[model samples]
Target chain A: MEILKKLKILADSAKYDVSCSSSGSKRTNQPGGLGNSASSGICHTWTADGRCISLLKILQSNNCVYNCSYCVNRVSNDLPRATLTPDELCELTINFYRRNYIEGLFLSTAIYSSPDHTMEMLLQTVKKLREEHNFHGYIHLKAIPGADNLLIEAAGKYVDRMSVNIELPSERGLRLLAPQKKREAIIKPMTFLTSNIAARKAERRKSRKAPSFVPAGQTTQLIVGATPDPDLQILKLSENMYKRFGLKRVYYSAYVPVSHHPHLPDISSPPLLREHRIYQADWLLRFYGFQADELLNEKNPNFTEDYDPKTDWALRNLDYFPVEINRADYEKLLRVPGIGVKSARKILTARRMHSLDFDDLKRIGITMKRAQYFITCKGKYSGQTAMEEHLLRPRLTLSPPKTAGPEQPSLFSFSSDVIAPEDAFSSVTGEI
Target chain B: MLDFVYDGSFNGLLTAIYEIYYRRQVPQQLLSSPGQTPKLFVREERIITDETKAGKVYEAIDTKISSRSLRHIYYAYLSEHMEAGIWIYHYLHLGWKLGNKLDLLLSDERVHRIHRLSQKVSMERHRLLGLLRFQLLRGNIYYAALEPDHNVVELLAPHFAARMAGQNWVIHDVSRDLAAVFNRKEWVATDFTLQHRLELLKEEEYYQQLWQEYYNSMAISSRINPRLQKRCMPQRYWKHLVELS
Candidate 1:
């Protein structure tokens, strides 16, 4: 088959895995290297889905041996199969990098023939890209769940990032959908990679010449809405993963129903809003110092679809609010519904000069619409007549209707504009 | 009200700023040569671009303030905002007083304005690093043309130079009529204009088509949000975007 035909099949197959970040690594260009990975990832283009396309996300092959019900390339599914030679993949990456089409490659594959065979092919392609082609570009390779430990370790040296997808959140979910994939197969590699990365870091501290191991660290994706996993369960699992495995990111991909099975949810579309909310709660867990129980619990297992998780948390815990903005510490400021990491830092820096009022808060880039009810600037409340739950709840829940007209100039304006709470929510959370 | 006008260059702006401190008189407005317009009761002073005076101000900024502040000042100059020169003057004045702590005074209007303008310029430069698409021209030279809002071609050169170290490339800021040429070893900026269109390689056209095909195919049809897409990447940048074009 022609290369373009294979790319179409492979890329289309790989589109469901939405972990597109090329960040956290800073690989400089060698004297004769073709590319380098920036510490902060760059999005080369935005797809029609409004998601950033940063990497050449493609699979080595779509041929599968395992029967994962939620996947498009499961052995039971009769999709067209295609695999690229190691040389073909290298040439494609170099050509694309030269044309400035992508930052690097996101190479994934299904279980073709066997896990070891698939991983070896991936290692060969990445090894050739690094050694023969002299490509220093960001490469994100997928670690086959049941692949050899030595193979995974060797491949980790060449790629900037690697991920072993915990496709379903729970062991029960994995057993029901993907019977061949055991929970141990996934967690073992993550544990191994995490320990090895720590060892490499200690080695590098002793000697600067020690080569980096998975410089960007490992990230994993969890398929939301595929199983009957509650938001609380998922968040708890993620929280544990972060504590245990030292994962860089836990991407939440809204499960798109690609295959029809008796056990799977009979929905036509993915639960994108739920995925988005999970990402919001996930961000709070990662950056905003919020725990899983703080965001949601057994009684309230799901996040509200209207207001963000932060707003929901704030509304639930109203007594915490009316906190004096001037006197509040950084942690207290972060609890406000509208202030993010960036604005919180801005407020901290700006407040050192003078006491900040509501106007100054706006200038420092806080979303006053949501934060006003929760904060008092200089012992004065600028919110509505009463900070009652009924009034505030309705006001916060009402998502601003999409503005009609030629695109607003404010949309294209610089970063200092009063960030809409939803915009802040989406910026940190990956787009659908 | 006095107006100090100078040649439209970063050094010229610094020289005007130097004059403001030397003369012990604050100009109501600092204008670039092209921005200057005759007005009643406005005293206009044509400040020459003096490298020595500009160097003094630049070195003082590096000495008193941090090197990061110097970068912010240069970025703010590249922003080409109508009030950028005045803002930079005020920022430098404050920097001289507070030394390195001037950056911490984000609440000060002058400091905030300069910081915001510099942030805008830097953001655009970072965006162009990814958004700028190269088309393979004759002689295996990768060429890209863009019209960024800020004068960021020079800022973008080092990044591309590091990435494409073994390849020849030219990034043309068509609006400014300036090009950054990287010839496999070192990069140089020059005033360049296209006299004739060179025929692109056939493989280049084929690859561009393939890219468009991949881009269209990759998007999930159910979640097509044109508003969000426009917000992330404005239509102004679409003309030169190979897939969108």
Candidate 2:
């Protein structure tokens, strides 16, 4: 197949990096503009793996100069290589946009020659999309770490969200696994983006018409279970990243063993449960007002497979439990097991009208199965057993099998109960 | 049990609700025209779809309850659930006294039922926003065909009209025989039919092929979870999706 026609080859190469979130930017369609970005983002489809196909996530080119060992399109690898021209990229994005196949384009690339050339190619394609095609859709362009700051800066203006992947958590993992990729090379571009994104916001504050730069801010991804790096190390790194730089999200992809390198762990399947736990912890940090240290400490560096990060935190600190549902503030409600941001808000709202009971809690959409142990409605506990770590630990551990199992996922399909509650935000009304 | 029949138009539904109030009769079922006949001996009345009465009820919901409640009632009505009319009646009956607080009483079965049906309809609307696939017709019209759970094709028009302001498009909800046809200036929802399978442009096929190839290659084989995929985009929606075929 011609290099330009090998859409599958480039897409397969680009599929592993999982940062498809298209939210944060609200670029309205200009008069006669071909597209616009929704503030919350619209997920167009779900791929077979169940991951959302929100954007046309593709690479500009897969022929690489640097050989990252974990990557499918490394220099030494013999995979089919292809490059989409700037016009080809625009055409595909516009055609897809017209058909509602995607929210926007998620353009990344392997270092085809130098980082500068590759970044320029990405920048060129996005600029053409905006200028020639009059497209205003969400664009998430990946920043090449070692690329020049000018190219990165130029790319930011045309894109909604930009990301630089810190694939390995620790510098030591970076040294061992990817010899060519220095930790400083990645950090330098990230720091630049962090400052520039901030400066542009300050400018927009002064003048609303000042053109937005990376309106959705920036994001980064870390490969989990790639090395012997503990979950503590991963969480700590994410904590520092969020605090130090105002990044939007830090995605954790369970390292799929693409090749058998001596440095890589000989795991049969990706550690999806660990990834899910880390994501749960990450959510707590971002939305639920929890710190990394609160969830994990040095004494227990790794998350146990027995419980989720929140449940583990609740169990370790039982003193915070038995919070009175009616009187407990929003923060206290959040700390309780199984009370998510939505449910916590629900409890607060329902509490105003009348004091809640266990029955009311259930109606308010609280996950009573897990929450029954931690909370008291009308000062009455509803757990099957008393509120002790030994008693609750057995009950709290997830009974439902992981969505992505350790072995081939098809062997033990998850029951409906496990799947139903997901992203349901099923907490029904209380606009009251 | 009292049964109310009317045209399956939103205005007609509102007119039924208006009659329910003026006649001081509680209805057990609200059936749309050409709808199923009521069982033997059930009191049935066909309501005339009066824009004037509907306008009055629409204004009353906004003034008495909040505009938010108006949205809830409208969305619940669109759900076309069998008992939605009765629930809305119960909701409005209590809402007259409780006003805005009616929704806040989440524990109330009537209020909760209205919210739940509305949620189901809106969720499907959000899904179809992402799932509706537009193909280019031979006449340069961007055409899409879908069978949404609720009548959301009209709802989806403003978004597409803003995004694709330069182009003419038609979003046809095949199940209901309704289509949202948009010219550059404005859009209208009207009765439409396909007559036959749409003749798409040859380039439209090429783009769909490219999209299919891209979609297929995007999934990581190591983490393939058909169950999750099905949950998010169920099998019922796969009929119109080009990538699925």
CAPRI band of model 1?
A: medium
* Positional deviation of residue A244's Cα in model 1 after best superposition, in angstroms: 0.6
Candidate 1 lDDT (Cα, 0 to 1): 0.86
What TM-score would candidate 2 get against the native? 0.95
Q: What TM-score would you report for chain A in candidate 1?
A: 0.93
lDDT of 2 by residue, B108-193 (tens): 67877898988888898888889999999888998989988788888788988988888999999999999999999999999999
Off by over 4 Å in 1: A400-432, B35-38
Candidate 1 residue pairs in backbone clash: none
Task: Give stretches of model 2 more than 4 Å off.
Answer: A1-4, A400-432
Task: Kindly list the per-residue Cα lDDT of model 2 for residues A1-432, writing each as its tens digit.
Answer: 653367888899889988887899899998878888988788999888788889999998899988777878889988888888999889888989999999999999988888888889999999999999899999999999889999999989999999999999988998888899898999999999999999999999999999899999999999988878889999999999999998999988888878888888777567666676678788888777899999888899887666777889999999888899889888888888778887887777777678888877777566777788888877788786888889888787665555664544432222222433352112111010
lDDT at residue B49 of model 2 (Cα atoms): 97
> What's the TM-score of every candidate structure?
0.94, 0.95
What is the CA-based DockQ of model 2? Answer: 0.60
